[model samples]
Target: MKNEVITIDLGSNSFRVLKYDYLNFKIIDEYHQVTGLADGLIDSGIISFEALNRVVEALCIAKDKLNFNPNNAVCVTTAAMRKAKNSNEALEYIVKNSGAKFKIIDAEEEARLTLLAIKYALKREKIDTQNFTLLDIGGGSTELTISFEDKIYTKSFDFGIVTMTQKALKDGKLFEDLRNQEIVIKEFLATLDFSIKDFPFIATAGTPTTIASIKLGYSYFNYDKNVVNGTILDIEDLENSLKLLKEKSLEELVALVGKGRVEYLEIGTYIYKLFFNVLEKSKSIVLDDGLREGVAIDYALSLK
Candidate 1:
């Protein structure tokens, strides 16, 4: 078990802990909790006491489940912590209550770690990794990464499903907001002075994977990551999935994608659709691997 390592990806919406047997190159155990650490963070510049408690409780639960030393685990917090005004105090509280030491990584480092995971995943899937655009949608930010031979470029946007939904609902401009975001991203790309057309598009994270699950006719209760990985999602299929998601009520949405995710799926799908159109990609491969996997990969690399 000395070769086993733990990676905690404390995201804006979800908190995940993975026990990886790096020697065998496989995940031995994993824990996922929808802590919603970024919930209500848009209006309040600080992490609320309730949100902090939720994260701490989840961390404690994951610690017991995996029985890993908190000091040994590589735990990384993303956008929520980065934007929180009281992040230091929040970290102190989490460590005191749960013994989980977490680090807040910048967007650039976040994208780099995520790229490591995506690259490993693509190689495992027998897909070409020389050229591809990766879309990683989180709760507080979305990262669009373009990877070419020995060079990778990434731009992180502030609006993710959680923050986007909060702002749009507060302003009553969901459609307009989505359109504005799409325009902003396109403009940012234009400034890069390079074309992204013809690059293989790959998306990792909850939204695309959830849509793939629905397309495969698997409910939240029966979701299978193995089948979900490497799934190809065409633009037409995404549109259809959006329509289908919109038709479902909150209860039905929960039945399909789980509780913590129901409210944001529709908006997430809208963002996914916008990115596909912006990238001029008709189809994209969806992968379930993400930050947690990337952290594990980096830790394993460090040992070597």
Candidate 2:
């Protein structure tokens, strides 16, 4: 028998599990499910039962796929679980029902892990230390990490696709009015001293990769080949996708893409547009891997 490490990433919009074989240093199995854990948390600060049940079911399914014992697994929840008012309750429920203990990772750790994963996946030994920024946009939060010549500065913002969409709806911001939200986003980025031209950007998470997949003409997302260490996105293609997606209804968007992602697909598209517009950057390197891979790398590093 071989030792394997199970990494479970309980995200705001999805639940993912990855099993890595220690001996081979390779990912053996991966699973994902859309749970939308942050669906209504923007206004209420509490995760709804519907969302909770969905996530729990996803976890149970992931657990069943584990070839190793549950006790050997390490589970962690990110933005969605962290922001929920009843986070402890939700955490307890997962532990009690799923027999999976989860550690709620903080923003700083999230940023650090994201950087680690980028380094590992890209194998960029000599990153342009002078001017480089890494962005990981999740369902409930977005993390920004600015790397200068010698140091890394990081911050986690509450604005994410799901949370942003909920806020926009609550405030009656028209779904089509992406330009109107620029002021709010500009202010948010200003707090971090982020300027679009300050550095080249690297983006992680589903939106960037999905956009990359669309650019490559992938009818269905191919995570392994299309996403991981994927090529940079073309700005014009991204703009075109955003334009096309905006004109779509919920059903239409899902039909074009797939089911379960319609709820946040439009918002995610908007976010991609907003981020690129703010940075004034025409393109970004899309990283298919994010926090879960980061967590695994962090765990591996700790052993050394």
Candidate 3:
């Protein structure tokens, strides 16, 4: 099937791969693994040897799942690779070892693709995206896009769950770190002239989806996109969840959530809380689809 395509989305916290059939416009197989690529990026300003190896190992596993042939795949990396000083080395190592070519996209391109995914999800949920705002939270950066009549406003922030955890919260000052990041979010949000209250908010990417799953009593192993796609993520609900998450020790947190999530779950959830409060939204629709969907769509179209 020439219409079949594979897309790999490399993130600071995880690596995701999906197989899509352009002919049917359906995703056939999906895989994700947390490699903690961002954990070593903050202080190092480069991709550490260990982090690069972890991602390459994950990519190799992904290749096997896709039958060890991903030549037809569209492999792209996001904020971490785009911002890391040693990104080229890390990507090249993957190419050398795994035979998968990775393209690091800029912030604008990242936001644009995420918006496309939001539109796809909205159509499925029978919602209008013409006047809506989309938030795509990643492990290394956050993207916000607002669409209105004949115009669009978009911005990408440097703060992300894994990045924020390594950069801010590791020093035992969780609230202080959150307050600082919130200031950055608020100032960037204030630049927008659009009436934020006019449009409903939709959030894409892992943080919200994971939060939605936890709120609905599920985990990564038992996650259901259909259940989360149109779920409401409220600020108050997350505030309560934060208190619960904070009480757990590191080991307990990982036991509760997965190892990939425990370290930064609190910060990620808090960021969600900050977004709702700063944007003046009590709750937002959660979308499980993300950049991977957008990548699949684009790769599918390019197959023509």
Candidate 4:
């Protein structure tokens, strides 16, 4: 009989439950909720009570969604958990309430696991994995992985949508008169020698995929994997999306970007534009699968 495993990915912005069939090597079911688990982690250096409760509530929803009892599930926390000053306390609270043991993974391991998701998805799509770069922008960090000339290289950027937004545009405005922000991005990009233009670019994770979905006019949370995965997103789409988003109020933005994702969507767009602009090629392939899928894949492989 095929073994079933549930992977609960505790992300900075959302909590996701993925039911993976190890024997089939595929995700059979998935659930997502934005609990803002890292909302104030950057400033306070601890997981806020609100964030903790949000996670707990999301966990309850996930637990009830599955056919099997959720006690069999394996929960894991990412960058947000690592940054919290009281991570141990936060995790203990989670276990006490959720009946799930959460594992905190390191940065390098996180990057490596993200690669697994891309590799698996690309293989399924029959796309060329020979020479490409993956830009994974999450809530708390971005993972950049490049495969050039048969060698794979990876590095993680500590800043993500939330951290970058809070740092640069905390005024709760989108793309203000800050010509200075471009210089910041440019300087940060300069530290990395890889050319985005030379290789096939693949953007994974919430921010990129969300931007891609929005451009495609997919209703919020109505994302279709077939329509989204391996789809090309134009640089112009980022510009137009940002322009449209800049015009909306918080309530309206939530309706458009989906609840719980509005906070970082604007910042996500700017970050998207920053990376998309660097590519000599004007478009990028969007992959819906990312760290969560990677975690499932890694776990499945370990059992082999």
The Cα local distance difference test for each model comes to: 0.89, 0.74, 0.81, 0.78
Top candidate by TM-score: 1
Name the runs in model 1 displaced over 4 angstroms.
none
Residue-wise C-alpha lDDT for candidate 2, range 196-266, written one tens digit per residue: 47577888887777667666766334435433354687578677777768787767666555566766666
TM-score of 1: 0.96
Angstrom error at residue 172, model 1:
1.0
Error of 1 at 289 (Å): 0.5
| Candidate 2 segments exceeding 4 Å error | 124-131, 174-198, 221-228, 246-252
Candidate 3: lDDT of 207? Answer: 77
What's the TM-score of each model vs. the native? 0.96, 0.86, 0.92, 0.89
Q: List the residue pairs that clash in candidate 3.
A: none
Q: Which stretches in model 4 have alpha-carbon errors above 4 Å?
A: 169-197, 279-281
Task: Give one digit per residue, the lDDT tens place, for model 4 in 1-304.
Answer: 2587888878888788898988789678888898988887767788888888888888888777865455677777788888888999999998888777898988777778888888899999889657887888888877777777756677666777877776664555445523454555456557666675667889987777777777778857577777889888887878777787778787876776788787787778777776666444578898888777888888888988
lDDT of 3 by residue, 263-286 (tens): 777778877877787788877999
Kindly report which residue pairs in candidate 4 clash with one another: none
Model 3 alpha-carbon drift over 4 Å, by segment: 169-174, 247-256
